[model samples]
Structures are given as C-alpha cells and as structure tokens.
Target: MNQELSESLDKSCKDLYKEETKYFDYIKKIKETAPNLKNYKTNKSKKIDQAFESILSYHEEAREVIQRKIRYANEGLKTTNLLIKKYVQQELISKLPGWEGSSNPPPLCGKIPANNNYIASNGDLVAASIPDENTGSAIILCHVKTYSKTTQEYKLVDFFEDLNKGPSYYTLPKEDVIPIPRTLSSKHLSQTEFSKNEKVLAVYPETTTFYPAIVLESPGSRTKKGFDTFYYSLRFVNDFVEQIEVYARFVIPNNEK
Candidate 1:
C-alpha cells in the first residue's frame, strides 16, 4: 500500500507541476498582449509560489513519514534477531556434540572451535567462510569432507553436491568454520527462523536449483523498498551484494541439497 500511495503521490505532483507551468504560460500571454495588468501577473506568481511551497512541504512530510516507518521496522527487526540468537544458542547449537549440557560450552562466542574435540565430525554440515576470486568471500554452506587434527584445517565440500566438482572443495581454517548441528531441522532455519549469516541454499531467480547463499535478512521482504513480500533478502555466494531475492519457499536449511 505504501508503494502504491507513493507512486500516486509522485504522479499527482508531476501533473500539478505541468498544470502550473501552463498557468504561467497563460498569464505570460496577458502580460505580452496588455501591458497595464503587470500587477495581476505579479500577484498570480505569488499565489503560484505559495502553492509550490505547500507542495514542497507536503513532499518533505511524506518523506519523513516513510523514514519513520523505516526506523520502526528496523527496531522491530533488531529485537527479532536478538530473540533468534538467544533461541539458537539455547536450543539449536546447545544440542550439538560438544555442547552436551557440559559446564564448558562449545566455542560459539567467536564461532571457532577451540580444539579438534570441540569441532564437528566428518560429514557434519558447517558454514565455512572461505573465499576465492570467484565466490567473493561470502560464507558457503558445506559438509565436512575431512579435517586434520594436527593442522587444524578442514576440508569441506558443498552440501550434498558432487565430490568430483573441483570448485566444491573448500579448505577453511579452524577459525572460519562454523559447525552446524546434525539434528537441526528445516523448520528451525526457515524464514524468520534463520539467524544472521546462517548458511542456506536459496534458489536463484528463474532457476529451480538451489545455490549457496548467506542470510542477510531472513523472511525479509526486500524491506529497503518498503515491501512486505515473501522474499529472503540474500547475497549469493558468488557476488558481494546484488539484486537477489529468493522466495521463502525456495530458501531452505543448509542440510538440504
């Protein structure tokens, strides 16, 4: 509704400006044809100026209203994210291997595993922040292909993808790897259920195949444009930030291929 209203207001402003121009042209004719009524043109111009000022003021107020709505929406989003973080820390990751209700919790504060024992095992899904010239450094979702305890390095493969694919292999440091829970379900990571920077496979527009992406805004309607559509504001692994909006249905948890 806000989008439609904004467009309509803009159209009206243009139409009014066109008519205002025509009015000045009409009065200019009177000035040219009769020199005695110069005061009339001056008074008419003042009235037009007043009307234009009112229109300008109206535009400013409308802009302020939109900005206020944006501020409110952002505040709500911040609160929602805080709640998701708390829930994930309590429910999701808390159930992972090393976090078996132990006194010493897993390394979640910085998201790096403290040691080999704290890290996930082979075939466990993880979000690896590996970057290459092509992928542009966004976190790509993958499953642990292998890990070297001595080197503290992990070999990750794109989640459920073919192992023969050369690009699918991701070698990440212990610090860049985030282990995902083996029991985490699709429902826990869907839309508003997703946490900030959560690993995901979102469908690229006009394609059925899900690709690697990270969550920027979960259940996000591309809110930058004041939209409330069913879209996940995502950044595909290949690009830094571009026109990427995957429908909610197309966005799924990292475990799914």
Candidate 2:
C-alpha cells in the first residue's frame, strides 16, 4: 500500500511538472511575440495567470507531502519531493518574469470596421487569446462581415491558433476583437497609365487575391479628380459578382506580373 501511494504521488508530481514546463515555454513565446505587453492586454495572459496559480498551489501541496514524508523518515519520498521543489524553483520560477510583464489584455472587439475586404460577411479571420473551451477572452476583425455600422457590434471571427489556415463564421462581441490591418503600398499609381476598358489586375478585397479586371471608369469610383492617388471601379473578368472598387496602388498592371 505504501509503495502504491508513493508511485501515485510521483506520477502526479511529474505530470504537474510537465504542465508547468509548458506554461514556462508559452511565457517565453509571449515575450518574443508580444514585446510591448503593456499595450495589449489579452486572454492569453489570463491563461498564463491561471497556469501560474495552479503551479503555486501544486508546489505548496507537494511541499506539505514532502514535510510529512520527512517527519516519518521516509527517505524515498523525501528525495522525490526535493527533486520536485528543485524543478519548480529553478526551471519554472526563473522564467516567470516574462509572463508577469504581459499585463495588458487585448480589447474584446474593435469598434470600427476593418479597412480591408479580406474579411467578408462569412470570410474574415480571427484568433482567440486562449483555447476555445476556456472562458478567457478574444480579439476580432473584418470587411463584408464589416463593422456593424448600425449596431457597433463586432463578431469574433476566429482563434489565433487558426490564423494560418484562415477563419470562417464565428461571431464574437465588440469588446473581444482585434482588427488586423491590411498593408498598403507607399508608391502611388500614375493617373495617366489607367483608362476605361483597359484590362488590368485588381486586388479582390474578399480574399486579397489579385484577379484580371477591366477598368470600367477612370479614377476608380473612390478616387476624386483632385486627389493624387485614386481608386478605380473594376469588373473582374468572368466574375459573376458585382463590380468591386479598389485603390490605384492595389491594382496591378497585368504586364508587371
């Protein structure tokens, strides 16, 4: 019976230790990925806090168990507990400063619509700060699903874990969103180079994909005559959808590619 109990205790300690190790590694990643932790509070940090709290509690319980074993003069249990303490103090505690620094959490969602079109009503992507099952928090973004102009309510699009593959229809609240901005080129397009009925490549806002389009109107629909840079309304070749308006800089001349 004593041997069985000892084995069980050892297994439990090792399992908890492994979990703590993962927490420590995650903290390191946060430090590298989110250096200005003070500016961006997020559910990710909250999960880190939960993990830290669990570690502290586990350490305390292990200490009590060790003390009991020592009082009974159980050499094996005493040694095992000492090792656990060493791992907690050395490996886990040493890396906690990085985690402690990430105090600011991200907002629940953005108040305005994201400036780009990749975020369609059902196409925009998003990432939650923590795992889905956990009740922590998340950030949001989009275009078609755009900001609810009438309501100011934003949908949680997806989780950060799936940022690589892309996100589908997942609605989150306004406070839990982080808008991902699209990068625009600094070089402006020349006005004379574009003309009506000219075939060119235009950026499709829905997926950021560039497709062949015919220029239906010069100075794209969004561009004003006096503006140095303008937008153009384009009819994508073979597209059954409505004409899309795009910035001059985003339109690529088919020859350039």
Candidate 3:
C-alpha cells in the first residue's frame, strides 16, 4: 500500500512540473513576438487616432471605477454628513488627479457650442490680416472659466523655445500647438484688449461660484502652410479658492485655403 501511494505522489509532481513548463514557454513565445505582431503596425495618422482613442478610453475607465467604488462603499450606509465625508475620503478623493484637498477641486473647462463660419479678408499687411492672399484664415474664439478658493488667470505661452532653434517658416501640427492666424500680429493686442473683442460673444460663470467664467477665440484654423493663429490659456487658481472650474469654446472657419 505504501509503495503504491508513493508512486502516485511522484506522478502527480511530474505532471504539475510539466504543466508549469508549458505555460512558461507559452509566455516566452508571446513576449518574443509581441514587437513583430501585425496589430502593432500602424501608419502615423492611425497612430494619432489610436492615441486619442486611448486617452478617451482611459478617461472613461477611470471615471467608471471611481463611481463604482463610491457606490459600493455607500451601499446601506447612512446619509449623514459624517458618512458622506468618510465615503468620499475612502473612495473618491484620492482617485481624482490634482485634487489637493476638499477645499481645492479640479476645474472643468471644454469647448462650448461649436461654430463654423465663413469670413473673407483681403490678404493685408495689418496686425489682423492673413499674410498671404492665396491662403484664407478665420478666427477661433475660446473661453475658460475657473471657480475655486483661488482666482485663475489665463495666458498663452510660446510653445517653441525660439525661432532660431529651427526654420523660421514651418508648419506645426495642430496637436502640438494651439492654432493662431499669422495674419494677426501678436503684438497688436494687449492681453486684456485681446480678451475683449467684438467677436467675443458671451461669457458666464459656471455652476461653481468659486470658478470664474472666460471666453477666448483664435482668428483662424491650422493649415498646411502653418497655423494662421497660435494661442493658449493659463488658469491661475487664487490662493483663497480650493476648487476651479473652466469652460471654453473655439470658433473655427468652415473653409481653409
């Protein structure tokens, strides 16, 4: 009886080892072929599309995970203020990015109603006209509002370190930099004056009282030649405000030369 039991145990051990080796080999093969996998090959445009898709996917997944955790924790719990505080601390607060404290909330800002218009201008040598006659341009209006314990200020920064770094004339990818029409000279508009233009439609505060409302627009869209416009927004959270909210819109033209 003892000999038979020992033989059975030895066979089981050998079988387990064989299974483990098979799985290990399988994993090794996958890793070796991963780089050459057909699915990984993509054109530049497809890569960009994939990147954007990935960003959206991650955003959605994170949101769902946060909500699910919050719901699970709050199940059957009392709706008291203390319970609310505990649930947020245990589930939601840390999951959020850039969330410093309950006092400081993340700002929400995005393009509002999309507007596409057609405007024609003679290629002029003025501060607000396109440089070339053949190429057409339009204005883009973007607005941002932030509410929090801190006041927010917006500004556009030069994406390129310096013109001398590369060719003076070059076309930048729309994703790499904000599009600003070259027809309009950056020097022409003071920060405040630029912020307030007739093209400026409406600006309103968001639901959060702490967030301030903002409206911004660029005079044109990006083209093969170059971006007719270049602009960016800088939000400064006031020392007093803990949370910031932002909303904006970009006015693009219907056609581009």
Model 2, C-alpha of 139: deviation from truth (Å)? 30
User: How would you encode candidate 2's per-residue C-alpha lDDT over 58-100 as one tens digit per residue?
Assistant: 6656656655654554566555545543442233223322111
Stretches of candidate 2 above 4 Å error? 1-193, 220-229
Ten contiguous residues minimizing lDDT sum, candidate 3 = 158-167
- The predicted structure with the larger TM-score, 1 or 3, is 1
Model 3, residue 176: C-alpha shift (Å) = 95
* lDDT tens readout by residue for model 1, 159-190: 42332112268777887776543422222223
Candidate 1 accuracy as TM-score: 0.31
In model 1, pairs of residues that clash are none
For model 1, the local distance difference test gives 0.55
User: Candidate 1 at residue 169, lDDT?
Assistant: 84
**Where is model 2 poorest over a 10-residue stretch in terms of lDDT?**
103-112
Query: What's the lDDT for residue 12 in model 3?
Result: 60
Off by over 4 Å in 3: 41-257
- The per-model lDDT (C-alpha) reads 0.55, 0.46, 0.29
Task: Report the candidate with higher lDDT, 1 versus 2.
Answer: 1
lDDT, model 1, position 70: 54
What is candidate 3's lDDT per residue for 1-257, written digit by digit as tens? 12344346456655655665565565555545655766655566466556555655665565566556545434523233234334422332233222123222212111121123212122210111112344453111221111122322222111111111221222222221222222222222222122422232111121101112222332221212353333322122232533222222221121222
User: With candidate 1 superimposed using the best TM-score fit, by how many Å does residue 79's alpha carbon deviate from the native?
Assistant: 1.6
Residues forming the 10-long window of minimal summed lDDT in candidate 1: 183-192
